[model samples]
Target: MNAKQIIVTKNSEEKEFYSEDKLRASLRSCGATNNQIDVIISQINAHIYNGITTNDIYKKAFSILKKFDRTFASRYSLKRALFELGPTGYPFERLISALLKEKGFKTKVGVVLQGHCVTHEVDVLAEKDGIAYAIECKFHSDSRATSNVKVPLYINSRFLDVQKHWNGNSNNGTHLKQGWLVTNTRFTKDAVDYGKCIGLTLLSWDYPKGNGIKTNIDSYGLYPVTALTTLTKKEKQQLITRDVILLKELYYNIQVLQNLNISANRIRQTKNEMGKLLHYDTFTNGTR
Candidate 1:
C-alpha cells in the first residue's frame, strides 16, 4: 500500500492520512540531518500500516535517532519524558518550582496559602520583584489527557479568593500577582479561551505556540533528568527521587551516582552526557 494512503491514529483517537512532510519537518527541527531524515522516512514508509499509531511512529523514530546521538534522541523524546514524570504529580510540581528558581524567582512547592473563602494548596508559588504567582500544575500520565475549560474556571475562582485577601494584606504590600494553570499536555480551545478571558496564564506542552514548556525548556537549556537518553527509566526515576530533577543538578553533583551503585565507567558516561547537555566539562578538555 502507498505510505501516503496509510491512515494514522493519534492518542486522542483522531485519524488522518499520514503526512511524510509533517514527520520530516519534526525530525528536521530536532536536528536530524537530511541523510538521517531520509533514513527515518524510508524506514517509516516500510514500517507503517493503516491504523498504526503516532506513538509507534515516535518510538520508531526515537529508536533511530538514539543511534545517531543521545542528545538528539532525548530532545525528540522530551514530551514522552514529561509523561515519565508521573502518575504522582509531586515531581512535576517541584520541576516547575525549579524552573521558576532558574528565572530568579523564589519558589515553594505544595504550599498551603489562605484564601478569602477557605485555604488552598498551591502546586507552586513563585515570587520575584514583589510579585507572587500561584501556579496549578495539571499532570497527566496518559498522552491524550487534556485540560478543559473547567480547569481554568476552577483556578480563576481560587485565584480570586486568594487575590482578595492578598491585596488586603498589610505586610510590606506583598500581593498575589498572577494565577497560572500549567499542564504537561495540551489545553482545549475552551480552556485557552476562558483562561485568556479571565486573565489566567496557561502553559501547556505546546500552548502559546513557542512559549510553552517545550520551548521554554529548550530556550533555558535546563532539561529534566527524564530527558537524558543515557539514563534508563529506573535510573531516571532514582534521580528524580533523589531530588535531582534537572540535568544541571545531576551535573553539579556527580557523586550522587555513587549512592545508586552506578559503575565508574557508567558514571563517566552519564557525566559526559550531562556535560554536553549542561555545557560543562570544559576543564577536562583543557579549555578552562
Candidate 2:
C-alpha cells in the first residue's frame, strides 16, 4: 500500500504521505546521517498503517532515532518538544530570551513599557549593538495552531506607539527599535505577509526556511529541557515552573531533581539520559 494513501495529518487533513526521499530530506535537515535516515525510514515503513497522523509518524521516528543517537533525536524533536514547555508560556518566553542572550543580546522578559497610547507588557525586550527590539512571543500548546494576522496587527500597533514616545537611552546608545513576533508554531500566510509589509520580524517554525526558529535552536544547541525523554511530564513541569528552561541547565543542576522528591536512582537515570541526549558528560564536566 502507498504511504500517502494511508496517513492522515494531525489537523484531520487527509493527504498523501511523502515518499522516503522526502522523509530522508527532512531527517537530513536535522543533521541525521544517511545510514540513520535509512534505518529510521525503514522502521517507520514497517509500522505504517491507515489513518496514522503525522504526529504519530514523527513520534515513532523520533523514538527510533533516540535509540540510535539521542542528540539527533533531541534536535529532531525540537518542534514538538516546544509544546511541552508550557501549561503557561512563561518558560517559552524565558527560552526565547535565553536564545537571544546567546546571540549577545541582553534580554528582559515580561516587562511593562509605557507606549504613547497605553501600557504594553512586552514578552521579551532585547538590546544589542545599539538597537532595541520589542519581542512578542506567542506560544501554542497545540502544534497545529498558527499565529494569525491579528497577532502581528496588534503587536505592530503597540510597537508604533512605543516608538513614537521612545526616549533615547544614553547608556546603550540605542536610537533604533524594531518589533519582532516569534512563535513556537508556524504563522499564517496573512501574518507573514503583514509582518513583511510592515517590516516587523516574524520568526516561527519552518516559515522562513533556513533562518527559522528550528535553525536557530539547532545552531545554538539550545534544546529545551522538555525534550529529554528521561523525565516524566510531572518532572518536566516541576523544572519549567522553577525556570530551568534549557537542557544544559538541567544537566548541570541535577541536584535540583532532589528538591522534586525524585529518587537518587531516578536522578542518576535522568543525568545519564540527558548526557546522551545532549552529547555532553553530565557527570564529569559542566557546560558552563
Candidate 3:
C-alpha cells in the first residue's frame, strides 16, 4: 500500500495524506544522512495507516532515533525542544536575547521602554550597529497554531509607537531600525504579507529560508537543556527553574544534576551526549 494514500492527522487538527518527501525534508533538516533517512522511512512505512497522527509518528521515530544516538534524537526533536522552553514566554524571550547576543546584538529581556503613546514592556530590546529593535515574542506552546494577521498588525502598531518615541529621544545616537515579532511556531500568509507591507520583521521557525530561528539555533548548537532525551520532563523543568536553559549552560555545571538527585551514571551519559550535541566531539551519522 502506498503510504501517500494513508490519511494522517496533524497536530493542528488538519488531515492530509502522508507525504514521504515531507518526512525526508524534516529528517534532513536535523542532519539525518541519506541512509539513516532511508532506514527511518522503511520502518515508518511498515506501521502507517489511515488516521494515524503526526505526533504519534514523531514519537515512534524519536524512540528509534535515540537507540541509534542521543544527539541525533535531540536534533530530530528540535521543534519539541522549542516547545519545552515554555509554558511561559520568559524563557523563550531569554532564548531570543541569547541568540541575538550571539549575532553581536546588545540585548535586554523583559525591558520596559516608553512608547510615544504610553510605556510598553518590551519582551526584548536589542541593539546592533547603531540600530535598535523593539522585539515582541509570541511564544506558543501549541505547535499547531500559527500567528495570524492580527498578530503582526498589532506588532506594527506597537513598533510605530516605540519608533516615534525613539526617533525623538536620540537613543544615545542609535535609532530604532526595526520591530521584530519572533515566534517558535509558523506565521500565516496574511501575517507575513502585513509584516512585509509595513516593514516589520516577522521571524518564525522556517521563515527567510536560510536564516531563521531554527537555522540560527542549529548553526549555533544552542540546544536547550530540555533537548536532552536522557532527562525526564520533570528533570528538565527543574533545570529551567534554576535558570539553566541551554545545553552549554548545563555543560559547564554538570554537577547541578546531582542537586536533582539524578544518578551518577545517568549524569555521565548526559554529559557524553551533551558533548556530541554541542559538537565538542566530532559529529557522525551512525550510532555511537
By the lDDT metric, which is better: model 1 or model 2?
Answer: 1
Error of 2 at 254 (Å): 1.7
Report the number of backbone clashes for model 3. Answer: 0
Runs of candidate 1 exceeding 4 Å displacement: 282-288
The sequence of per-residue lDDT tens digits that candidate 3 reaches over residues 178-257 is 99999999999999888898889888999967888888888887788878999999999999999899888888788899
lDDT by residue (1-288, candidate 1, tens digit) is: 999899999988999999999999889877789999999899989978999999899999999998987777888888888899886899888778877887899999998888888999999989898889999999999988889998899988998898888888787346688899999998999999998887899999888997888887877776889998877799999988888888777777888888888899988877777676665663674121
- Per model, state how many residue pairs clash: 0, 1, 0
**Cα lDDT of model 2 by residue, 156-265, tens digit:** 99998876666533444574479999999888899999999999999987768898888887777678888777678788888888889897788778789999988999
Which clashing pairs does model 3 show?
none
Worst 10 residues of 1 by lDDT: 279-288
Candidate 3: residue 110 Cα off by (Å): 0.5
Question: Cα lDDT of model 2 overall?
Answer: 0.81
Q: What is the C-alpha local distance difference test score of candidate 1?
A: 0.86
- Candidate 3 regions off by >4 Å? 281-288
Query: Please, what is the whole-model Cα lDDT of each candidate in the order they appear?
Result: 0.86, 0.81, 0.87
Q: What TM-score does each of the candidates earn? A: 0.94, 0.89, 0.94
What is the number of residue pairs that collide in model 2?
1
lDDT of 3: 0.87
